[model samples]
Target: MARKAAIIGGGVIGGGWAARFLLNGWDVAVFDPDPEAPRKVGEVIANARQALPALSDVPMPAEGKLSFVSTITEAVEGSEYIQESVSERLDLKHRVFAQIQQVAPGVLIGSSTSGFKPSELQEKAPEPGMIFVAHPFNPVYLLPLAEVVPSPKNPPEAIERAKEILREIGMFPLHVRKEIDAHIADRFLEAVWREALWLVKDGIATTEEIDEAIRMGFGLRWGQMGLFETYRVAGGEAGMKHFMAQFGPCLTWPWTKLMDVPEFNDELVDLIAGQSDAQSGHHSIRELERIRDSNLIGFLRALKERNWGAGKVLREHDERKAAAFFGATDSAPKAAPLEMAHMQVLPGWIDYNGHMTESRYYFANSETIDAFLRLIGAGMDYVAAGHSYYSAETHIRHLGEAKLGDRLTGTIQIISADEKRFRSFVRIMKGEDCVATIEQLCLHVDMAAGKSSPASAEVWAKLKAVADAHANLPLPEGAGRAVGQRK
Candidate 1:
C-alpha cells in the first residue's frame, strides 16, 4: 500500500515538500488556513512538474494526487507522516503541534522550523515522540538535503523511518545528533548572514556582490563536495590534518570578527534593498528562479552520473521513487499490455476528416514499436554498432477511427526469428479494443556497408531468447499475412 503524507501551511516550503512527495508517488493531503492555498500550491507544482523530471535520466514516477483540506485534523486523519511548515513563530508552531497531535497519534510529525529546537517545540505538544524538526533548504524539491533533528524523547525508530521516507522523496536526510537551537546547517548560515550584513553596513560589498562571490566561486564546488572536503582535497597528500594545520593560524588573526553581530536599522535595510534593486534591474524573481532551477538540474545530474557520495544518494532516491510508482499494488492495471508506448489522438494529430492521418498512424505505431525494441535493448546504440534490424515490409490493417484524447496503446509480439530475418505481430489498442495490427518482416542490416547481412551471433541469441519467452502469448488475430509467406 502507498503511504500518505500530510503537509500543513501550504506556503513555499510546504508546497516544495508537497512536490517532492508527489513526484515520488506518495499521495499528499495539504491543509492551510489561506483560501488561496490551492492556487498557490498548484502554481508551485506546475513548475515542479516540468523541472523535476529534467533532473534525472530515469522516467519520473506517476504523479500522486494532491488534495486540499480546510482543517489540519482532516488532512492528518490517516497520514503516516505530517510535515508542519507553518510560520516560524514558537507560539504558532506550538499551537499547530497541539492540533496535529490530537489527530495523528502515532504518526511521525516534522516541523519545518529552521531555528527552533525539538525540545522547545515539544513543550506545547502532548507527546514528544510525535514531533521533531525537519529543516529543509529553500526550493526543497530541487535541493536534496533535509536536516532532521529529533527530540530526545522521540523514538529512535521514528527518526530512522523518517530518514527512509525522506530518501524515497529524493532528499538526503542528515540526522542531527543533538537538538540545539537553530540546529546544524542554520548556525553556519546565521554566521554568514551576519558577515553579509556587516559587509553591507561598512559598504564593502553589496548584496549582489556577496551572492556573486558565493555562486561564482565556492558555491559551484559546494553542491558536489562540502567546504571542508574541497579544502582537504586541496591539501594534497597530507589530507585533513595538514590542511587544518596550515589554516589554523588564520583563525587567530583579526581578519574576521567571528563573534560580532550586526544591527538591523532602517538605514541598513534601505541600503540593502537599494543594492538589491540595482543588481536585479534586468530580470524578475521568477526568471532568476527558473535559471537557478535549470542550473541545479544540470549540476546535480552530472554529479549523479559520477556516483559520488551525493550522487549515490540521488541514485538510491531514484530507485526508491521507481519502486513506489510501479510497486503500488492497488493501482489500476495498465489499460493495455505493458508492451509499447502509445499516444492518444490529440488536437494536433487529427486531420479535417476527424480521423488520424494515414502517415501519422504509421509514425505513431513505428515509434511505439521502437519504444518496445529499446526496452529490450535493441535501441539506437545497438543499431549504430554496424548491425540493426530494419522493416523490409509492413502490412497495416486499420479497423476503427481514433478520435482526440482517446486512450491508446500498442503491443508487439515476435512471431518468428532467425539469423537474417525476423517477423513481428503488433496490435494498436484503443481502450479494450484492438484497433489495428501490423505484420512486419525485418531484415538485419549492416549499416557500415549498407547491405542486408546476418545478425551478430550475440544479437541472434538475445532475439531468440526474447522470442521464446513470449512465444506462448497469443498474436493479434486479425494480423494480415505477409506477401512472401513461409511454410
Candidate 2:
C-alpha cells in the first residue's frame, strides 16, 4: 500500500508540506479550521505542480490526490505520519499534540515548531517518544534544509525515521544534538539581526542595503558550501591551522557587539520601514516572490549538476519519487495503449485563417512524439548534450479543418529504425475523427557541429529494443506513407 501523510494546519507552511508530499506521490489528508482552507491549499498545490518541475532535471512524478477533512481525527485515521503545523503558541501546540496522541497512537507525529524544543512539545502528548520536532524554513517545498530535534523521552529510532521521510521529500535533515532555545539556524540569524539593528540605530546602512550585502556577496557561495568550508579553502597551501594563526588575533578587536541587544522602539521601527521603502521604491509582494522563486530555481539547479551536498539530496529525492510512481526495475512497464493531453492553440501558431494553421498539425504531432522521447531518456538535456535525433523530412496529409478554439489529440507509433535513423507515424484526431496524418524520418544529429552523425552504440541499442517492442502494434488509420510519397 502507498504511504499516507496527514497535515494539520493549512497556512503557508502546512500547504508547502502538502505540496512536497503530494508531488512525491503520497496520499495527503489535510485538517484546517479555515472555511476556505481547501481552496487555498489547492491553489498552492497547483502552483507547485508548475514550479517544482522546472527546479530539477528529471521529470516530475504523477501528482497525488489531496483530500480535506473537517476534523483532525478524520485526517489522521490510518495515516503513517502526522505533521502538526498549527499556531506556534506553546499552549496551542500542546492542545493539538494531546488531540493527536489520543487518536493516532503509533504513527509518528512531527511538530513544525521553529523555536520550541521537543521536550516542551512532549509534555502535551501521552507518549513522548511518538512526538518530535521537525522545523522547516519558509517556502518549505523549495528550501531543502530541515532541523529535526527530538526530546530525551523520544525513541532514538524516531530521528532516523524522520530523516528518511524528510529525505524522501527532498529535504536535508540535521539532528540537533542538544535542545537549545532557538536551535542552530535561528541562533546565527539572531546574531546577524542584532548587528543589523545596531546599524539601523546608528544610521550606518538601511535594511535593504544589509540584505543586498549578504545576497550579492558571500551568500551565493554559501548555498553550495558552508562558511567554514569556504574559509578552509581560502587558507590555501598552508591550510586551516596556518590561516587561523594569522587571523585569530582579530577576534579580540572591538569590531562587533555580538552580545548587545537593540531596543525595538517606535522610532527605530519607523526608520527601518522608511529606509526599506526608499530602497525598494515600489514593487508588489507577488512580483518579488516570483523573482525570488526564479532565482532560487536557477541557483539550486546549478548546484544539482555537480552533485554537491544539497544537490545530492535533491537528486536522491527525485529518484525516489520516480521509482515510487514508475515502479521498481523488476516490475514491467505499465502498458499505456494511448495517451491524451489538452493543448491550447497558441496565437503564434494561428494563420490568417484565424485558426490553427496547417503547419501546427505537424508541430503538435511532433510534440507528442517528443513526450515519448522523454520516456525513453531522449529529453531536452539529451538534445543539449549533442546526442539527439532531428527530423530529416516529414510528410503531412491534412484531411479536416481545425480552428483555433478546437481541442485536438495526437497518437503516435514507431514504424522502423536502424543504427542512424528512425521512422515514425503520427495521427491528429479530433472528436474521434482523424484530421491529419504525418510521417517523419529522423536522423541522429551532432548538436555541437550541426552535422548528421550515427547514433551511439548505447542509444542505438535502447532505440532498437523500444522499436522492436512496439513494432507489432498496428498504426492508427489515416497514418500516411513517408511525407514525400503519396498513399
| Candidate 2 local lDDT, residue 253 | 93
How displaced is residue 182 in candidate 2, in Å? 1.6
- TM, every model: 0.76, 0.75
lDDT per model vs. reference: 0.79, 0.76
Assess the local accuracy of residue 219 in candidate 2 as a C-alpha lDDT between 0 and 100.
83
What tens-digit string does per-residue lDDT give for candidate 1 at 199-302? Answer: 88998998999999999999888776888899999788999899989998998888765588767789989999899899986887667777777777778778
For model 1, state the Cα shift of residue 228 in Å.
1.2
In the predicted model 2, the residue pairs found to clash are 395-483
Models, CA RMSD each: 6.8, 6.4
